[model samples]
Target: VERRSASFALRMVVHIVGDVHQPLHAADGVDANHPGGDIGGNARRFLPDCNATNLHALWDSGGGRYSLHWVSTKPEWEAMRAALLRDARQMVQNRTAVAAMDPLRFASALETATWEEAVEALSMSGGFGLVRQMIGESAGIAESEVFVGLQMNPHSFGGPLPCPDAAYFANAASVSTQRIIVGGYRLSFFLRHIAARLRRQGLLVQGGDNVFFGVTNAWEAAPNAALH
Candidate 1:
């Protein structure tokens, strides 16, 4: 299984690490009334300047493009990446305190939601263990944290319906940025651990420069609720 070791594992990690950082990608709109969940906010609709139309769609585009559209070309991606890097730089400066936050602690807090989803068995070992934990945290954020005090349906409806304004989009973007930062920190947690093990085996995984960074906290202990 040498082919499935190290390099392959690293590739998979890269793909999924970006995913877990996306608040909406990891979330599900849920409540006491409809305990079954809103299928990751697909059940809700809103207008976010662009025509993407749903709550999930807005986040799927990274919330920077309020005018709902996809990043389909290299040029578009480059522009978006530049904006993101700037935001990330500023975020790092502003939240220098986030360095103390623990990804493992956050993972456990998110796992509290797994019992609600009845996935404890699947969350048993290896990749399933991490997936279960990450997705649980994602759902935890989706179920309550992202809504920002707005009213949403507690029952079976898709939304309270977003009659959104400028402030709403701004808050959405802010939340998205925070989540993305946390995602990078979490990715580092895995690689750094792997590096420690590799060092024991007389190997090293090297990257360039002083590219090290930190993390922010998971949602505050508000009964483990979240929204997308």
Candidate 2:
């Protein structure tokens, strides 16, 4: 294995863990199988009038929208981000497919969320063992490469420097920033809201406060971007 820089490796490891946590990423399904055209979350329509597009895209980008200019202070946003980060960290540390699958399915539907239901769901014990295992194996390789790269170059690839030209990086950086702000936690909130709203419709948040898709492959039945 190549030698990698510690900082570079840490970030890569963090990202790799997140990627594997997403059930869709673990899926080997055929895109053509979905009735919706695969627009990467842009094709399918979700409710709430806020985001009415593809599921994958919402999961990928919706986290940023939650903290939009709607809030006046960055502190509020940071607080929410911190809480989310904590929940995410817990999810990674104690991931359980069975415990997570129920809420995962509920969230996948894009329904409304409520604290009452969230509290109830958090009491179950489906578990994150499989999630932890996969993350451990996959994230390691990615981090090694990232750290090794850092060792080879003092200037980070995205860091300011004799790195890539600014124009070359502009679009990529913008998108990356967008994901950090609008993805993950934000998306989780939106879906939880949707689930709470649709609770009357036979949808319920399962497990204990976790909402990961494919926690048990139930949401795998939902429409995909390619299906649009």
Q: Quick one: best lDDT, which candidate?
A: 1
How far does residue 125 in candidate 1 sit from its true spot (Å)?
6.1
RMSD of 2: 18.9
Question: Residue-wise lDDT of candidate 1 within 113-189, one digit each (tens)?
Answer: 43423233334544566556667777677655566654465233434464445566677767666666666545544
| lDDT, model 1 | 0.51
Residue 78 alpha-carbon offset, candidate 1, angstroms: 3.5
Whole-model lDDT per candidate? 0.51, 0.34
lDDT of 1 at 117: 37
Clashes of 1: 10
lDDT tens digits, residues 1-228, model 2? 112232244335335434543333333222333344223323333334433133343334322223223355888867865655553443334223422533234343233435554434432334443334444433342233211211122143322212322332343334333223223332343333434444554434355433322312222211111111
Point out where model 2 deviates above 4 Å: 1-4, 28-52, 60-73, 85-228
Q: Against the true structure, whose TM-score is highest?
A: 1
